[model samples]
Target: MALTAFVCGCTGNDRSQPQAVVILGAASTKDLLSDIAEAASNSLDRPVEIEISTGPSHALAQQILSGAPADLYVSANRQWAEAVVDADLAEPAVDWLSNALVVVVPADPTVAVDRLEDLASESVKRVAIAGENVPAGIYAQQALSYYQLWEPLSASGKIIRGHDVRSTLAYAERGEVDAAIVYATDARLTDGVRVIARLDPASHSPIVYSLVRLHGESPAADAVYQFFVGDEARHIAERYGFQAFSVSQDEE
Candidate 1:
């Protein structure tokens, strides 16, 4: 993504501030930002506006580099963040948060799936997962491949592919897919969804969030950044099943 600074504070008396915060959000983090944006009108003490375009992380990254007017960049993985920083579109990178991978079953369980590995059981006829390109899907693939479940599970013609994490979640929530792979956050949001297992962080690729400030930093932009890394934002994310980023012993 090309480098561009974001507006820092409330633009004076102007009743409407036309702006957009571009997020390479993994289907899970979008809601947290939306809630904060809704309160912007009052909390920002000025006219506030936001727009989001979502897809696979690669797609979002491409959009940003193609001169997409993104005020800030938030990504589901550090890889995308590093891409932007490498391109000089954003400042030095910082990992902001994390989420855990989980297996989900239908809201009304006719087919019972219990463990992360249970997804491969012959009794489970169909399972849904995000495309390999999506982070959630990538994590799922890694975990199953570790357990050597991918080939056996796919051989049964039971693995259905969703375009993104949320889609796979929808499959489980609606009972369209007997089981699905998704982020814990997604499972928490969908009312009919039930979580069967959360992958131990050590069991698969790490789930990390990377946030960067667009060069034209504004008060609103900074506020968004500050809040995301702060306790209030962490709580908002937790309510929806997101595991807040924790400092590792290495950092301490």
Candidate 2:
């Protein structure tokens, strides 16, 4: 997803100090967060103008550390969120959502990889995954390693690294790679790709999305944050195929 910003609430010459809230989020949450922001604007009394910028969680954290303007930070994993908190750039992070990894192929099915093991087959040429430092890449690495395929695939030079999960999925969507490992939520957003298998949750570390309030106090930003952690946002997240942390906990 391109780094885009959507304005919510009122827009026009009536700009009597519209609260501007900047949110730096993980790439996969782009659409989901936009919907939540729209709902938040409608429900909140004060007019809020929210600008969301998204990328790999690790990169976003680094940007925040480098003084990027962000009132809130939503990470795809806890590690990057904690990094911000550790730098005193934000408050303690809270678990908000969960996701599952999936193996996706082109919609036309050019590759013969119907299963995870098929990734190792001679017919499979390239496999796309996010960079090693990215959350999706970390999870994919763990899952591939769990199946004992990481080393062989890595040695064969078949692993194609993308800057982020969305870009990784694009590799499969465009048929540039034989397949890709991405979030289930991401696969749902695109019609150019088809999910062949869902990786077992036990194969990797839990895919938890963590949110934090960057050190500051903006009523608008706080309101949006509250709405995000509230029930309404949970329902919206579910609609986007994300599992709310509360729901996952209940399942456990």
Candidate 3:
């Protein structure tokens, strides 16, 4: 997917100086982070302009490694988050959110894929999934492999790769593909698609949305990061179908 950026809380009047906090988030968290940014801007005392850029988790991580300006990094998986931490670009990442994978088909009842195994059937022609480098695709592949369906599906040339989870879901939403594997949260975003099956959590690695506080000393950035881990943020995430990870649980 194209790297997209948005600036929130900006004013029409040219400000001589404004505190800005930059956030790099995974594509799946795009809407969620946007909501959080608005809320954070409202709750903060000062004029804080929040900038958000989103794409596939791996791509975002590479940007961070390449000196992209980011005060906070929210990854869809631990691997990329830890890569940043390992590179000393940020502090150790904290698992902040979680999501589940699901098989979705067009809302049209005629396009049905009721089970994981059904993906291999001729009836389900094209299946859309993110590239393997993306977290959503990685999780989908793991789940499919656990059920012994990856090889068969790959060999049949039925798998279509999307740049990110949102794009993957779009393929099913637009009826360009018979089915798609995406996050439950993404599936909820559109009425054009219906979830046929949720991949079992045990079938793949834990879907942890890890957060990193990039090395920076801006109070605005600190405030934004704190707000993200606060109670209100957790509520916002839950509304988006994301399970908030308790900091205490991580400590334990």
Task: Name the candidate that leads on TM-score.
Answer: 2
Cα distance off (Å), candidate 3, residue 101? 0.6
Candidates' C-alpha lDDT = 0.70, 0.90, 0.88
Judge candidate 3 against the unseen true structure and give its global Cα lDDT, from 0 to 1: 0.88
Ranking by TM-score: 2, 3, 1
lDDT by residue for model 1 (1-252), tens: 212222223455765655455444545666766664554433555444555445666567677778776656667888877787788887766776778888889879887787777777768888898887777788888877777888898888988999877778888888898888888777778779888887777768788877666566566566555555566666766777667775333321
Clashes (backbone N, CA, C under 3 Å), per candidate, total 8, 0, 0
- Tens-digit per-residue lDDT, 161-220, candidate 2: 999999999999899999999999999999999999999999999999998888897888
In the range 33-140, model 3's lDDT, one tens digit per residue, is 999999887787656888888899999999889998889999999999999999988877898999999999988745568877789998877989999999999999
Name the candidate, 2 or 3, with the larger TM-score value. Answer: 2
lDDT of 2 at 223: 83
- In model 2, the worst 10-residue window by lDDT is 243-252
- Cα error, candidate 3, residue 124 (Å): 1.8
